[model samples]
Target: MLWGRIYFGVQAAAGAAWWIAVAVSPFVREVTLGGLDPVAVAAADIPLFVVGSALAASGVRPAVWVATGWTLVVAIALAVYATVTTEAGWGALVMATAAVASVLALCLVLTGRVPTAWLIAGPFSFRPALPRRIAAAHLVSTGAQIVVFWGFFLVVVPLVITSLENRWSVTLPFPSFVPVVGAVVLVLASGLGLWSGVTMSVVGNGTPLPAAMANRLVIAGPYRFIRNPMAVAGFLQGAAVGLLLSSWLVVAYGVLGAVLWNHAIRPHEEADLEKRFGDDFRRYRDTVRCWVPAISR
Candidate 1:
């Protein structure tokens, strides 16, 4: 449980760091791709990122408390930044909505007292314990994720940005000066998402499923709400990337990601689950919606 807590805390902090980067990319020199002057905006985001990074490194219960506080702070900062920087009237509203949703989701992870039953860490936790076949599958899935994102960002997005008119202008409905929204969203989502996945993996680690990797089927905490909450959240994170870069190609990549998960990954995972848990897996599947929680049991 201590390991789990530590892992979760670090993940949260890393995520917060990412969010801070996104919220204040204008201020952060490294984040500025080129041509956009975001000195004031990045300046505003620096402290938040620093604080979040510090808290994540601390790795104590106190750190958890700090993470919780920072999550709220990041949200507020993003909201304020959005209101100030947006030239489009509707853009402010959209940014505000996204900010609120992002914050709410972050809060859910930061503050919620997830049961210890779902927390675990160490080399033997999940990754090491994965069976050969299932491990291969996971590798393939992870590789696919990388290929899609990198291919789009490096090759496809640049072409679109060069060819299309007002390409850079096509950002999330946030303040122009605060282009860090997407980056922040990705950071936050990745941090929390990994924390959740690790926790689930720990809990289910030792149990042997018919499928080796399937043994790490977590049914508690975030998983209790949705069968593929992690995947869904990951999609949202991808969307944030598209929004941050204001690239149609990136956004399209995100959409393609959803399709890949739904059509390719989910079915394979479910088949494995059925093989492992049998009737229990079916019962759970029947109760839980794939991505949407509102329809879940």
Candidate 2:
């Protein structure tokens, strides 16, 4: 729900800024979408997005459906216009990123995998399930999650970032063996990620998703050495992929993900764990560092 609200708020704010730029700003007004003036289109976005934001804040489900459809159509239209106009730069990159984000958001909403309420709410907690039932279902659920996570993060996002880098002719030179080294790192990181996922499934009785969080405070496998092995593996894998692709932007993206995850998601996760497990989690947290492995044992 917090994320949902942020999405809607950004849309509303962006719509207003876009309108202001296209309407009265002389430099922006000179810009064209496929040789056509975007004045009317810009004018339409602000009110629509503002209303949608209001509706979302009120927890109206229908508003999300409508706003998502509207956003998707606009994104597609702009992307088509950019392609037709031979626009290849930051504008094109922004459009592509927005289009992908809109599509992913729509998919999440449609699948009902996320919480329904869009309004501000208390911290979410997943319903408890029998450990046996969760363990039994872990293989299927965790497998599906792995596929989705890999497809979206490793494939889709990298493709988009690489497109931006290619358009800007950005390249960072590296040794010939860099890719080989990256491959080795990728394999190691993947192994750690998989080991962590399996441990979460079997020992902790849950998936990696916060919505289906573990029942037990697992201290097995990679968890015993590092507090957030999965996160470490994910960051390493992203950086390795950037090295393999030879895209500096993708490497920076990996760094950005680590910062955001640490600041935005980590605190919430730790607070929730402490609330549930009390001193046990605090002790585990104090003993095990987040990014580094314990070596003096």
TM-score winner among the candidates? 2
- Give each model's clash number: 6, 0
- Across 96-192, the per-residue lDDT of candidate 2 in tens digits comes to 5655555445445446344323311242444333466647598667778888988799879988878756654345687888888888999999999
Tens-digit lDDT track of model 1 for 1-297: 343345444544554565456556553323222232445644644444345434544544454445445545645554344334432222233333334333433434456533222222232122224543434454454445445654665446645543331422334444674347777877776665655455444555522212224354578766787777667766776677666666554666677778766864566557757876788889889887777775344
lDDT of 2 at 194: 92
TM-score of 1: 0.41
The lowest-lDDT stretch of 10 consecutive residues in candidate 2 is 114-123
Model 1: lDDT of residue 62: 55
lDDT value for model 1: 0.51
Misplaced by over 4 Å in model 2 are 1-130, 133-136
lDDT for position 83 in model 2: 50
Clashes of 2: 0
RMSD, model 2, all Cα superposed?
7.9
Q: What C-alpha lDDT do the candidate models reach, one value each?
A: 0.51, 0.70
Residue pairs clashing, model 1: 19-184, 22-180, 26-38, 26-42, 27-42, 27-43
